[model samples]
Target: MEKRNKILNIEQIHTYYGVSHVIQGLSMYIEEQETVSILGRNGVGKTTTLRSIMGLTPPQSGTINIDGIDTSRWQPHKISKIGVAYVPAERHIFPGLTVEENLKLAARPGNGKDAWTFERVCDHFPVLAERTNQDGATLSGGEQQMLAISRALISNPRIIIMDEPSQGLSPLLVQMITDVVLKFCIKSGITMLIVEQNYRMALKVATRHYLMDTKGEIVKVASTRELVDDPEIIQSHLSV
Candidate 1:
């Protein structure tokens, strides 16, 4: 494979919540069109890492670079505007609004011919197209996840960072989401960073995996093939 340009970079990032340090000198990078995942059991600061990148929680120390620009102190909206999108596990779609309305609110027009338009996203997520007229809160958990992902795509972001996308779904829905995300990585060429407690789903979706320790640090970084070759890392790091 040819080398791709870097899109997101984190160097020794140390983030905090009221003086309680969560991310401890962590660093990583995502290249253009790469699918990267951070894997850990619950409460290992996986969400905080995404928050730090999104500027919802800025790092007190270290630097965050997005597309060669320093965004360590930038606000969340500004970070979002500059080609980064986040899909929180909470799936905060507007409950009272129709699915189409939720999508239109977040859409950003692009001059490129291949920009992710509403119709194109609908083609990818037919279930959301079916629920276009339905209220966001009225859809099943799986449909809402698809909507959240579609909304991000409609924005035409350079990279999409998802936090625990499989959190509240059943096994069937998890598999469905897994398939959707896998398709996105394989076909869309959209860069992705997934923070997942579901290591199985992450293993199937991400090309590279950052395994986190209980101390809120990356204990090991493994390629998907490496982890698959040695499944015991899952039992050691990701098992409950």
Candidate 2:
């Protein structure tokens, strides 16, 4: 298959968390309409990498480019407005708000044809429509995850950075999440950069994969087929 246009490109980024250096010269790239997965064990700066892209954790050095624009100097909202959406694993929805309200709150103002509406999100996640009036807190873990993804989709982003989308869930829920991601990539044509520990699930949806070592460095990158066919690469870096 032909490669899509480059959507997000990170070059040698370095970050810190209160004097502790993290994300040392980490770089990655995602093409348009492609699903790219970042795989690594826990505490390896995978979340930090996503934070850096969202400008939540500003990098000390290096550049972040989204659709050829220099977003390294942009704020989180600015980056978001430029079509970069983030779905953090924490599921940042309002617990007090209803499901519909949570979706509405994320709706962008002055967005054009590509912007997502409540109906569109409901179409993708029929359960959200069924629970439109339910309080966000009452939803199950899977529902919360769906809401988080819907909230991001409501922004109509050109690219979405997802962190641990399948964490803390039942196997069935994980499969559902995986199916949703694949549908988004294959059907909706949405570009994505996902951080996941479930290598098998991730490989099922991703076209390419990157590996981050415990030291916050990119140790390897390859196609999904290569990563699956060669288990040694995973065992070497991802093994406990």
Among the numbered candidates, top TM-score falls to 1
Q: Which residue pairs overlap in candidate 2's backbone?
A: none
TM-score of each: 0.95, 0.94
* TM-score between candidate 2 and the true structure: 0.94
Q: Write the per-residue lDDT of candidate 1 for residues 20-68, one digit (tens) a residue.
A: 9999999899898889999998888999999999999999999999988
- Per the 3 Å backbone cut-off, how many clashing residue pairs does candidate 2 have? 0
lDDT accuracy of residue 80 in candidate 2: 88
Off by over 4 Å in 2: 1-3, 109-115
